[model samples]
Target: MLVGPRPLTFVAVALAAAIVVNSEAASAQPDAGTSQAAKDAARELATKGIELYHKGRFAEALEQIQQAEERYAAPTHRVYIARCLVGLGRLVEAKAMYERLGSEPRPREMAPAVRDAYGAAATELTALEARIPKVAIAIVGASTGAELSIDGNPRPLPAGPIDVDPGSHVVVVTNGERRAERRFSAVEGAKVEVRLELAEAVQEEEQGSLVPAIVLFSVGGAATVVGAVTGGLSLAKVSELEERCVDGHCPASDQDEADFAEALGTTSTVTFAVAGAAVVTGIVLAVVRPGGSSANTGAAATSAKSIVIDPVVAPGFIGVRGRF
Candidate 1:
């Protein structure tokens, strides 16, 4: 949300001249090692910085002012740098410069020009503090295990109404395997609120359903049970035939029973084979949970609208039949 255009606060000619004169590079240094050449160079840099700043070439002015500060530190240099940063939309760094200037100790013998710069620093610090933007972030998930990050800088849980520079930023919230991301821009003097939610239902919905796999496994289990029952019955019939028959052949009455048992034995073998195939197929489906695959969806669509999975038995036939 763009609040409005941020205009640069123009520096009046009188104020800029006052800063260059009072910079005090040559006469005010406590160090005797400060040579006349270094002081001259510092003064020259500060003068050029003021000229560039007046023309709105803030980046070039900031470079000049920073070089001057490196050569010989002064309150005036910091004030100019802070102003340049403001012109560049870097409120946070600008606020820091003003803060540091305000915190430096003042000497009783300090020059009136230097004191004037100090007073200006204090006044600007107050305004800069108000102009620095704030961003509040909250995660609506587990109280523990969740982590929050702002522009790749990891922040602690319950991360806050944090101070930020006025610009675009990214907020990331993570809890275990779940993650959420948001992008927003912060405006000067404005507060932005962000919320992230990670829910179990959302995760479950994304990974597909387990219902189809469960159904396959249940049908496979029923087929296995039917095969086992038939196998046991066929074994019982063999034992009865062995007892009733002697030598290499069965009695006349036992012959028909023997033929029936032979058919039952064949039926048992086929039923067991079918059971094995079904159970194997069920294992495949359970391993690869269905509902998300195109092939699985197509199979489900083409399967019989009404179907049953059970052992089919009659006077002459015994087997298992069903569709999944």
Candidate 2:
């Protein structure tokens, strides 16, 4: 974010001077009683107006200043009235009054006050002419008082039409642990809007556990080992039968020979069955583990929503009050 030039303070100072000048002029007039009354009235009104202005009550200040102007006809009083108008956003009237004041020459003592007032008006006009672009960011998921940062610099919430260089910027919106980011481009005098929604954090524990997968692999390995042993035993039995029976006499009728062949067949069948079951069990276990790509069968779980980023002209960040 780019910082703009500070507003000129002369206008406000001139207004103060005007109020003092008018009060003093009223006091100096002939006829002590009437002059004293006018001075008292002007002083009271100007004091109230100044107080109101300080309190950010520009509208009320305008009212008070207007009343003072009606009760008195003095250039000094008019200057203050104009200042009040400027504070109230009535620029046209304020400009006219400032212009009128600028045209007249002032006494040596009043010269500084006049110069200050002119300077303030000139600063205001310069600011107005520049027309700084304002962007409003409304965050929905965070609280209104959530902190806002632009390119790592903290900025006040409900910020003014921020005067920014015409270019791109990175905006970060954060509240406690939740955070969102976006990029935007702005042109001179253009308003940019942005809205952000933070994604909830995903806990590691919720992802499937590796324990089940490890257990399955262990079981499978044990089964495979047992199957290989059984297969070896079956092959040995067959080899022994053939060796003892000689050529083709491997025992159709011989009880020992028949028994040996039956034992071998049974062992081979059992071994294959155990191995197949183990392999299937291992596969199932791997699929059930947390973080596995396959769907889990144990329990239903929820996942965080994916964040969406879109370009906008205005600030786009919001916050929620409670934790998820």
Over 4 Å off, model 1: 1-32, 142-146, 155-160, 175-177, 199-324
Which residue window of length 10 is worst by lDDT in model 2? 304-313
Scored by lDDT, model 1 comes in at 0.67
User: Would you list the C-alpha lDDT of every candidate in the order shown?
Assistant: 0.67, 0.55
lDDT of 1 by residue, 251-272 (tens): 8888787788788777777766
TM-scores, one per candidate: 0.53, 0.45
Report each candidate's C-alpha RMSD, comma-separated, in the order given: 12.1, 18.3
Give the count of colliding residue pairs in each prediction: 0, 28
- Report how far off residue 122 is in candidate 2 (Å): 6.0
Q: Taking the tens digit of each residue's C-alpha lDDT, what string does model 2 give over 295-319?
A: 3422344321121112111123222
